[model samples]
Target: AGSPTEATALVCLDLPSSQVEVVARSSSVAVEPEYLSIPEPIVFPTGGGKEVAYAFFYPPKNRDFVAPAGEKPPLLVKSHGGPTGATAAVLNLGIQYWTSRGIAVLDVNYRGSSGYGRAYREALKGRWGLVDVEDCIAGAQFLAAQGKVDGERLLIRGGSAGGYTTLAALTFHTVFKAGASYYGVSDLEALAQETHKFESHYLDSLIGPYPERRDLYRERSPIHHLEGLNCPVIFFQGLEDAIVPPNQAERMVAALQAKGIPVAYVPFAGEQHGFRQAANLKRALEAELYFYAQILGFPLAELIEPVPIANWPPPR
Candidate 1:
């Protein structure tokens, strides 16, 4: 079946007449066409200005709501998992959740991401934090320069390796105003030593052999450089996660608490790695949106349960 718009549908082929027939749809609820944002493939300069990175930019769209004139929508830079993973032009309701609510989404395929060829994927070797972080920053800046998003409201989020990129960006650079991490790595050295056997040596090529290049691990780790991350951040973590253990999120939350940065932590008890339970997934999404609304000063169209942000508004 052909999908001209973003949606989940069912169809069948009529081989005898060489025609297509609609069988059904995945969802019972009908989403108006005007509410779905189309993905636009974008290529823009990397931080060095030498090479370009790829991404799918989804601008905000909703028939019932419109931003005030001259107001640029906030941009959410999404770092996909696997660090080596690449994003695609598929229908993703998670992305739509942000766009339909007036937030633009930039799904980045930074250096080392797959689907771009071998050399591109290898570019992340020994340069995970540096290369990936720069590409994400570049994508947001590119959108701002193009007048597509508000420069002041640039935000980021990622899970697993992407989560590492989000932490690195907020820690090492001043570009993103705030960020969210879904079980992201904060300490590279810890990750190299603590991760499961399948991925135990994963960082060997990404960074270097453990202990042999321990210096690089410490240097690139966001946990070690928490002093640099002053902005607000919300963390969603599955308490049972083994890939990126709960410690990763807890450590950062603890540091943010001590430093008085506005931070929120939401942990799911029975879930592991990526959320599997339907209710937990929905809760996390709504919590992140609520956190953003409070931090960005944008009013939500509907009520959502509030997530507690520590150190917000500064006590008099």
Candidate 2:
């Protein structure tokens, strides 16, 4: 069942009262193993002298293509959604999509992220933007120090809560040169005032009681700190997103454009918090890849039609 290329298995566990049989499998599709980079676990130091965990995936092996000599591949630091959610070491085509095209990915499981026990998950309490942002930055620095990725060409991206971290990193730090926010939160205060019932009180734990500590919210919200954001960014939003709403992305796009930063925005009419439709998903992935290639000055292996970017300088 366990093979080098792919594996499938069925096992039975005998309990005191009954036997349970489960089927586990990997896709049989003929995706070349060389086109996929195995996930490597990493632990690095972050703020407050604490450490965080992440999984790093290097550029894939492609016989037909090679990067320019002496050029380290650009790194894309991915922040998984949920701030509570964690990135898994699964065979994800989405991660593979970037790796196969010569990009390195660091899937961060930042502090306050789940799966590291209740205490770590609670580490984000009253420090949503700070802990997550510092952990992500630390992961990128660790990789760069190891000479595994190009330090100058670092990019950060995420959706939902992860999107919030992406925006925070780009706004508050100078480490990332570019970013992509997929339906990310730009205004924590706005979110607290307008989010759905389920998350209406969620920030009370993530930040503090609303209105009581609203100043902290304003300080952490990326929209309010736009003066510090100078890098290129592309955003993808679902018009029907109720949790974060369209305005989250719209306002950020507007602000970046006003500052003459390179920016692009894509909105899907019928989508929600996360993209569901296959077509929209495909479009989002291709657009992000194209956006990064344009900003990082790299050639994409695929022939994706260019997505227009505002303030993008003409090719020299």
Candidate 3:
């Protein structure tokens, strides 16, 4: 129930003796305790002052390194997979991967995310692309405005439903400088019509009854609004993904390539909707970091195989 940096304890209250007994007070993790980044809960305004969203900000931390004087760290804004799922202050090594490497992380719990109450969850109904994207953008902007992160280096990433939000934000807004999508939905219409029955029914509330409100789907779809997305992006997809097939990432990558935008696509064989194998997970994370380093013109501390980017080093 506690984060990696914090410990959870179980205690007993003895009525007869009027004394407290401590049963448990510690937890363990693979990494050393001092190396883990701590999460700070943050609430910020979004929707042009119409609404508020929550997030957990983890600043860059390393036991042996210090950042350059007066240099702000780059930020990676994470949108959790389930549009319905909420992010907690849990010890996530995936998040620590960035923080441990001199990058700040903002794990956003946007408007539609659960655990905030009925009205908050209902906020996404009929407004999936709008409210969620707005909240994410706002969270990044809030941190930038507070002199916490480099606004020019704001990046976003997500998987599945969260990946949809990443694409929407990049396509419809100009806040982020780069992004990475893992099996994201580029076209909402395609997803509504092609996905399984459960997801199809779910979209009824998320984007409106499919056939009847088809116009909304097209308007919100990132594939249809590619012109707005001018920055670099990298995509990771499982070749055998069924929920969000590989075609989703392929189509977007192709479009970006044609537009001369910086893009990279890394597809894994035998992987599915979410990466389960240990090796694939590690490779995906390393590839994403490599992509960011190349785009941002920084040298990575570790040697990682470079991801080939289409339309890189645009003509000066």
Using TM-score as the yardstick, the better of models 1 and 2 is 1
Give all candidates' CA lDDT scores.
0.90, 0.86, 0.90
Cα RMSD (Å) per model?
A: 2.5, 3.2, 3.1
| Candidate 1 deviant stretches above 4 angstroms | 1-30
**Span of ten consecutive residues with least summed lDDT in model 3:** 1-10
Clashing pairs in 2: none
Give every collision pair in model 1.
Answer: none
| Tens digits of lDDT, candidate 2, 88-129 | 776677887787788899999998888888888888899999
Candidates ranked, most accurate by lDDT first: 1, 3, 2
CA deviation > 4 Å runs, candidate 2: 1-30, 48-50, 314-316
What is the Cα-based TM-score of model 3?
Answer: 0.92
Assess candidate 1 and give its TM-score to the true structure.
Answer: 0.92
Candidate 3 runs further than 4 Å off: 6-29
Candidate 1 global lDDT: 0.90
Worst 10 residues of 1 by lDDT: 1-10
Candidate 3: residue pairs that collide = none
CA lDDT, candidate 3, residue 220: 96
